[model samples]
Target: MIAFASFAQPPQDAIFPRHHPDVVDDMDVDLGEDDFERGYQRLTCPGEPITSSQAFMRGHGTYVDNEEVIASVAGTIERVNKLVTVRAVRSRYNPEVGDLVVGRITEVQPRRWKVDANSRQDAVLMLSSVNLPGGVQRRKLESDELQMRTFFEDGDLLVAEVQAFFADGAMSLHTRSLRYGKLRNGQLVTVPPALIRRLKSHFISLPCGVDLILGLNGYIWVSKHMSQSQQEGDAFDGEAVYSNRNDEIDGATRIAISRVSNIIRVFGAHFIPLTDTLLLEAYEWAVEQEGDVRDLLQEDVGDALVATVTAHN
Candidate 1:
């Protein structure tokens, strides 16, 4: 057995030097004045103390603890008056009053239909809220309840606005206006809800003969182009508005619709915000490609398309 020599230990002061508490805290939490001025800056995280509770009140996505305003979710900080809120970068749809949404009927109940609007709970669409086929002022009879499926059945998609809320916090939707009704002559495309920015008009008509409905819930409807006048004209034809039948879509219109849908898919993939001008620019560039609608899905083509659109934006 080999014998080991004993050595004196170094002084604790020299071996482990003490650091100032302020220095350590400063090193742990970096708060710079320039952090706020940066464009679209999101420099916050969950459980991170933002400021003293006495100075700022906690708001959504944040909580108060030990006289400190701390975030409850990872997101950027927002300030309104004395209230501080952290808006999560990615979250489920939080419906607000009068917000338009596109949803699919999940269940057909006695007088209300359960709709999936990408929310935590299924939304409620009552029979009384919908415009009957015969006319807008038509009364709902027990016979109407029997034929509720005729107006809205399971798996049928429609667009409507958030009218009210149920006792349990579920959304109540309404389709009293002609603009809100059964969806046809188009296909649904879903994206991250954050990408669908609030615009003056969610109903967009592309010059390529396609109509796009940008739902706040991120469900986009791409269909054959229709003018507002045409939409108004069809409002009287309740059969057409509520009809499950799709209007005749010509071959050219079909290709245009497919191309527009593909462009949107590409934009969503790249995490780009959808806007009327951006879409118009993208569509114009896509048409210039002289390629088939399916070509946009190719890796090189998709990347190039995104690059082109983003460059212009």
Candidate 2:
């Protein structure tokens, strides 16, 4: 049917870098022509060996040999037949059905909220799927179109599940489940879609108590939940220490800015597996910045972060 093989191995030094300290995190680990020039090798199809790299790239699918499968990103892995899927930490892979996801609202249709669910096309959020606070059954009343639409309008972030796939390639989504809904007071960290483990929604608690939403769909959200509003974002997975907000300027605001800013650096093909402790340390650093640099958080900090983590490791 579909042509897909597992991963394969190459010579040493040819071992493709799983996560490069300089590469932005959201990158695909493909054996491009340039990759060959860089001496990068295809390690495995889901961790399988490849005797011939060129032939394998000619559409010959490969799978991991035996059962030794290490995650490319630090996410959960799902063994679907001969193909093992990778889901990055904090995000889930968007499968046909029963997949939990954390998505950002990229656009708003008349009655649907267009969500970027870490895929090529944006998933639709129909008016009927949301669960209002009253439990009165959300019915998208007449006034809702004019008023509430702005509330969940474009740019609103949500955590949902793939309710069903439409015949037209688009997928229907629902947030009625408790574990599925809006994500609040959390930092959205985007990594290469491959880093995540597949098939399950795991809430990983970092060594520093940071809550990580590992979606099988390839989107991860990491943040500290200790604070009533927002916790002290640190640089490591060390213990939580209190500090003076006044001395640090816009404490929580800067942290929010920094956390969201870090997303761009990691949401690509070139990414690494971040440990729970490392994630916590980064969070702490974001919360304690000051001055005009407050807005500097939006920049892609992935390169620098990668370098720092690499040096430490």
C-alpha lDDT score of every prediction, in listed order: 0.84, 0.52
Model 2 C-alpha lDDT per residue in residues 1-313, reported as the tens digit of each score: 7854221223456676677688875435443334444532333333433223332322223333333333334333333323444443433344668667788888777767888887767788887786554344556887766654544756667777788887777777887754455565555766655555453336665444445676655677765544323322321212221111222324655445445335323423235554455555555544344423333233344444444545666
- What is the C-alpha lDDT profile of model 1 across 1-313, one tens digit per residue? 5763222233579987788766753423333444445646555788788777887778999888888878888988877667778899888888989888999999998889999999879999999999877456867889989989888889999999999997888999999987888999998998878889887888888888999999999889999998898887787876777788888999999999898888888877777889988888888988898999999877678888877877875
Model 1: CA > 4 A from native: 1-40
Candidate 2 weakest ten by summed lDDT: 235-244
Per-residue lDDT, model 2, residue 256, is: 50
Task: Indicate the residue-level lDDT of 128 in model 1.
Answer: 95
| Per-model tally of clashing residue pairs | 0, 62
Q: Largest lDDT belongs to which candidate?
A: 1
